[model samples]
Target: MSNVGQHLLSGGLSGFASTICLQPLDLLKTRLQQGDGSSGPRFASPTFTCVTIASTSARNLTVFRTARDIVAIQGPRGLWRGTNATLVRNVPGIALYMTALTHARSVMAVSPYFKAVQKYPSGDSRTRQGSVLPTLTMQGNLLSGATTRVAVGFILNPFSVLKARFESSIYAYESLSGGFMSIVRAGPSELFRGFLASSLRDAPYAGLFVVFYEGLKIETYWTSHTTSAGIHSFSAASAGALATIFTHPFDVIKTKVQVRSEARYHGLYKTIRTIMTQRGIAGFFDGVSLRLSRKVFSSAIGWAVYEGMLMLMASA
Candidate 1:
């Protein structure tokens, strides 16, 4: 296959594998972030924290309880409720993002302004051990990852909306097409709901992920004097954890804007205010554990599979 074709196939495979394995976590994260959809004054009062504490003591939606509830209500298959929408959104999304990143990095590698800093006399541009793509400066990595990710996120925002709503109990979207048509009828506003939050989350997350992943790989290679898929996976997972934590608030806001129809969630600023007022600081971290778990595993699997495939294809 051509290089671009190889990247497309590798990315699609990686996305599919990760999505299938971790769909349950994604669903759980959405459900937790969606909350009970009650934005009453009682939830915003100073005593609200005590009420929350008491409520949780009574019937908290812990991860295990959420999983159990889904299974009880819809069976085991319910855990993967949004798999179809996720696959449709992610397969092409990953493929395009990977391809764009590769092309961007390749272009940047050749540019005098963004070229990697040389450590040896030969001034080679090859990546360090365990990396297949051309090495560029950290700035290049950040720029390429952030720009490509946000652009792709924009293109797929509608599918993202569908996926979030599908995963939530709040929306009973019987089919992917039906859900999409509903959004279309709601106009561009609905189609692009949560896009700002998504961009905010994705840009930093993708950029920092690449920066951290590459830095870790280099450090690991230096320490261990070796490189392998295991090293790549470890690096990717570590990077994913760090980036997920830093960008999780936007994730919470994005989920709420997409999944809920209340007036409080109709706009980005309103959603942020609502979450802060009703749920306080802890609210932004809702489902963070689930998202963190999902991101770590997904990054590990997706990056390992993608890079490994490219290395194999290059050799072949």
Candidate 2:
């Protein structure tokens, strides 16, 4: 299959998987960010120590219980909250991330400056010649991560707004006009509350993902001699799990700003500080267990799907 087709198939399939795994959290996350605080009674602790739904109470259903309650209250429709906006935002976001990363790695490997930097004896050059590849590659890694996010944000910024608005109240999807108008009225600036930080968060995380995934594939194929699709899917899942850790705080902040524009976050700094003082560092890791599950499924399934699609398209 063509590389492009491979990416599309893997990415889309992984996205579906991730979505399913994370949907429950997405439901709770959306409501929590909107300050629903309805999970209070379910919690054993009366102090209301944290803003995350998981912190409040986890008895009978705990976070899962709250999730079920939400489903019961909102119906089956509720579980898929913000999913439309997620797709709209993530498809292009991921595309930009992966495509830019592929190009960056290729460029770093072939740069004339890097090639010239190789130290070599004419006879033994191939074996002894070390090059500036690592330095340039790291540079490429950072740039690809940052620039791609900025590029993708143009398309996804709107969806970020949509997801926030969609989950702001159940009224969001029920009344399309109101949802559209809410976003329209927020002004462009509000639509992208933490653009710079979000960019920072996405770039490194995604770049590392590319580095890890490519590296692992090479290692696995070379050592085990495995070329199976299942292996590739597993590699993708592993890379995704790693990316989730580094990028999660930004994810938390992104959700917050998108859902709670009235909360008054002037910038990433203030936003983080508020979360720390008001919610503590644990705030940065809200619903992390759920998020990890989502990422693994999404990455794994996305890889399989995207690969399968590539094979189909290439054969066609």
Candidate 3:
């Protein structure tokens, strides 16, 4: 198969694995971000701490309680409520993300700046005498990550909208088809309702993720401290954690904009203003910890598996 095809397969497999493992966390994060401020007793009483429905809750649910609530309400499978939509979104979303990243790097490599750098060969054998390519610059990594994330994110937004609704308390669709039909009934505009917020969140998050991950790898390689697999996973997790923290407010806004059953937010600016007025400074940071944990775990698993598959395929 072609290189792009391999990237697609590897990315799809890795993303699938990551999504399955982290779906519960993802659900919790979404629920927390969607929380409004009202709290009530859970019917099943998932845990010792307070737990409530997404729309009803003002405060974020604790991660432990969130997991328990899912089990209590819908059984263990409840945690994976949006699995189908998530898989559909992530599998191809990640494939396209990875492919775009790679192609972006290649495309960047041929730029005038890189071409100028290439004019002067490195002294290192791995980059010169041996069969190893040079690393991307920080700028290149950031640009590629942002560009790909925005492109694929926009394309796959409908799935994102569907997934959010599926996991949310807003809609109780029996099946994926039901959810799709409901969204269709809502109108085509609903699918792209949060496109601006999503792009704003995704573009910065993706850019920072690549920059930090690649930067970490560069440092690790320079230190010669571990194997490629170890470094890759570590870097991915580290990057994810940092990026999630920095861009968490955008995530909150994106979720709010995407999943509102009613038209609460007229636009991105108005949404931000409303959140600030209602929830204050803390509103934008709802579920930040949960988001960070989920992002770290998912990114680590996805990047590790993807690189491992590439290594295996190269060996084969």
TM-score of 3: 0.87
Tens-place lDDT per residue, model 3, 1-316, is 8888988899999889999898888888887777654244322112111223444564646778777877997898888888888998899999899877877788787876532244213575322211122347778878888988999999999889888877766556678887777666767777677889888889999999988987776666566556567777888899999888888888888888776543446579878887888789999998888889989999889988887777667657
Runs of candidate 1 exceeding 4 Å displacement = 36-59, 118-129, 225-227
lDDT of 2 at 313: 53
For 1-316, candidate 1 gives per-residue lDDT tens digits of 8889999999999999999999999999987887633533212123111122112311157889889978997899999999999999999999999999999899989998778865222333333345677777889888988999999999999999989988877666678898799888878998998999999999999999998988887777556644568778989999999999999999999998887666778888999898888778888899999999999999999998998888888878
Model 2 vs. true fold: TM: 0.72
TM-score of each: 0.90, 0.72, 0.87
Residue 25 miss distance in model 2 (angstroms): 3.7
- Point out the worst 10-residue segment of candidate 3 by lDDT: 42-51
Worst 10 residues of 1 by lDDT: 45-54
lDDT of 1: 0.83
How do these models rank on TM-score, best leading?
1, 3, 2
Q: Worst lDDT window (10 residues) for model 2?
A: 42-51
Comparison by lDDT, 2 against 3, better one: 3
Candidates' C-alpha lDDT? 0.83, 0.57, 0.76
| lDDT for residue 232 in candidate 3, whole number 0-100 | 76
